[model samples]
Target: MVKRCSWGTCNSDTRYPERIINVSFLPFPKPKTNYDACLRWIKACGRPVEQLNVNKITRDTYVCSKHFVGGFPSEKNPDPFPATGGQIYEARVKSRKRKYVELEHNSAEPSCSVPEVPCIDHVNPIILSRNENDKDTQTDEIVYTNLDLVAHNLSIKNLEEEKNALIKQNEDLKMQLASCVEQDFKLKSKRSPAKKHKQVVNNKKFSAETVANSNIKKLFEYYTGLTYVRFILLVNFLFPEEGINPVNYKEKRKEVKAMLLTDQLFLVLCRLRNGLHIKDLAYRFNIKPQSVSVIFKSVIHYMYLKLGYLSYWPHRDTIIQNMPQQYKQEFPTCLAIIDCTELKTEKPSSLKSQSQCYSDYKSSTTLKSLVVTDPRGSVIFVSDLFSGSISDNEICKESGFYKLLQQLKDQGYLQDNDGIMADKGFRIEKDLGELNLRLNIPPFASTATQMSSGDVALTRKIAAHRIHIERSINQIKNFKIVNRRIPGTLFYNINEIWTVCSLLTNFQDTLVKM
Candidate 1:
């Protein structure tokens, strides 16, 4: 039997060593051991899976070294395949070398074009030619310029300048005339008895003025995710100086066509709460799309800082005081419920980023964040967003939540017997032990065919309390920006936006009843 290269269109065979020199045949990987690598190799062979069988691979099945980088596969490139058929390593290198050799061989000789006779009517022009070698003799010719042609060219340039000047002057006069007409019209309108033209309001335009004029609380809530009174409070908190008179406030920097800072804030909130497109927001705000984007980023950054207090971890006494009746009766020591939530996002163009952001559970690209809520369903702490591929146990450990709990324990805010509630997905009992705190996760049926009766009851009770964290997560996702698939345009500030949404959920109505 002949050992032939299995690569696409490759003719390398052991029987014809003279036809293809310095090439060796490699056997296919065994499916039982390196199954994934073997599949990849078979796919790289460019043969249909139905036509090939890895189980029947014999010594005659192989791939040639010409398909690999560096003319061979090494430890660094054990699973080798050509990126493209035309980009085969050996072939590309040989083609490059052959072209270089042809250039070098051709350059060894010097060649020049024969000179042509100049027409009698026109001035002669100089010709330049250079050769690589020093063997060619060169000649120089005298050239003369046409005076009349040069003068005519200069006159035409002067005429163009004069024409440009006249155009500018005409535009200036037109502007002056229009200004005079506007002044005359204003004077006449003031003197005339004609009823003043009613100022037309654009209902489509969204701003503080529009919301105030509409006086619709639902519209306010729909746009900002906050009622009228709460929205006012939020504005005051974010911009204390301009809180009372944000509509009339003037910015030090020139505003976007005299737009108020409050309007910008309203625009940002509408974008976050409604997931409004940048162009739509621009149209509503009477500004350019770029301006809307800039305002949204700048204001959201400010809001991210202003809203940072919402993520504060409540003191132990505060947590106990706010603990719901259900938690107090069954699990008095329960402090906070924790859970990881994911939001779908656009698939990233990069393969590495796609892998990092993909969630097998969601089966889509997403961003994940850890949400921590007290028993009363108030979001106390929200961690920065992590890649969706991260595991719940890993997120809990790496998100600084455990470390912070340990710090609180050292400070006497968190005690040894106090418990952190979470689902069985969090395998952090050992981690909590290091912090001198207890994990209140429901019992897992690990190593058991079935859970005992007591384990079943405990699981139900824990799940009843754990449901608040889920509700809190739902509240955070109520903001449409984090609820739907986040666009790639917002990926740069996605962490900040996700944090803001999580924190803002603290301002919403409580999820857990007393």
Candidate 2:
């Protein structure tokens, strides 16, 4: 039996035996008389007991004011157990440290009236102090247990799942990006074809009338003889040894007359005389531009080398033999009037090139050529083309015109009886004396004789006679080919054309004046 201590003012309790000492309690009846018997009862009941010593018990009454010994009254002396009634109660105060309490039965409920003892149940198992009041508690239930391990395992699993989900999402995003890139590439590749199709749909075609109006057709007529095939064939017959041949006529072939007529050649001559562009000729003939260019070059080359012979100056002996009787005594050995002229052209592209071809007269690029004509207005000599950058004096010097004069002198053509009439630019009066030739040029009026007199009158007469060559030059220029800008490809061909036209002019003069 357990009892509360009588030290209420002292604050001591018997059930909590460590809290008080020096308090007397009456001895209770022993359950078994001997220690062996007590041990047997303890084993049978399977109950816990507090430690006791036989030496601590007194003979008349073993008193422990702190606690009772058993749950029974003594059979040998049965008076109610009395507490020691001494004011000398020794009180013990409990420490502030936590104490544990055990319930007597599994179903026992806590009471509000009793002072509470705080208890902790750790999830992880731990050893607990035994309670004398608790007899049937299981030992397995007393251990503290850890609660965090299961929570930790679950968190690790969740983290692994989240990682897998993120990896799958990243792969899906990469696939989507790749698809977008592929689509962009395909779109770019398709653009060029679409643009090309649009261009085709928007393109315009040229019309028949517009083609007819193009200069290409005129080019054909100017180049193809228009009808000069017959004259070409005829001249070819006369100069068979000089690389001229009929288009198809051969020996043992009956002299088949040409299917084409001479009127065509005359028409071509008229066109050449007019100097129309090859493209314009092509337009008139309804032919291709290239065809006109080729035909014109071939026919012009043929006529220049073959039928164009009459334009050249007569040989020295021929001139001597054919000199007119009236002038034979005065100027018996005169050859021709020589002059230079400028033909304008389009400006060249480069600045240096522009300088090379520039002429102050037209203030643009030009071709320069020299012409020598007899008193009759027939061209006897012509020089190769030169840039307009050259002056008349430079041209005369570089063209070897003086050399030709020397040659004529050596041949007895420039005897004391002969004289040449030239413009003021010739300045050859003193130079002619060295070559045994005489120069006749118009003289400038002096300050004293500002009004013209005898010498001026004679100079005018000579100039009037020399003016025929200028007229011939004008006639030659009537052909637009010579008057207009010549293409660079046709440069060599233009020289030939010049010779041919000069010869034609002489021929026509002779025919018409005869």
Task: For candidate 1, give the lDDT.
Answer: 0.74
| Model 2, span 200-317: residue lDDT tens | 4432112222222356745323333222334455544434664334332222222112212232243346457666666765555444556555555555666666655432545666
Q: What lDDT does the true structure give each of the candidates?
A: 0.74, 0.55
Q: Taking the tens digit of each residue's C-alpha lDDT, what string does model 1 give over 410-514?
A: 787888878888887888888888777788988889685899999999999998888888888888888898898888988888988998888877666788766
- Please tell me which predicted candidate would have the highest lDDT against the true structure: 1
Score every model by TM-score: 0.59, 0.46
Sequence-dependent TM-score of model 2? 0.46
Which window of 10 residues has the lowest lDDT sum in candidate 1?
96-105
Q: Model 2 off-target regions past 4 Å?
A: 1-271, 283-287, 303-311, 315-333, 410-417, 487-489, 510-514
How many residue pairs collide in each prediction?
0, 41
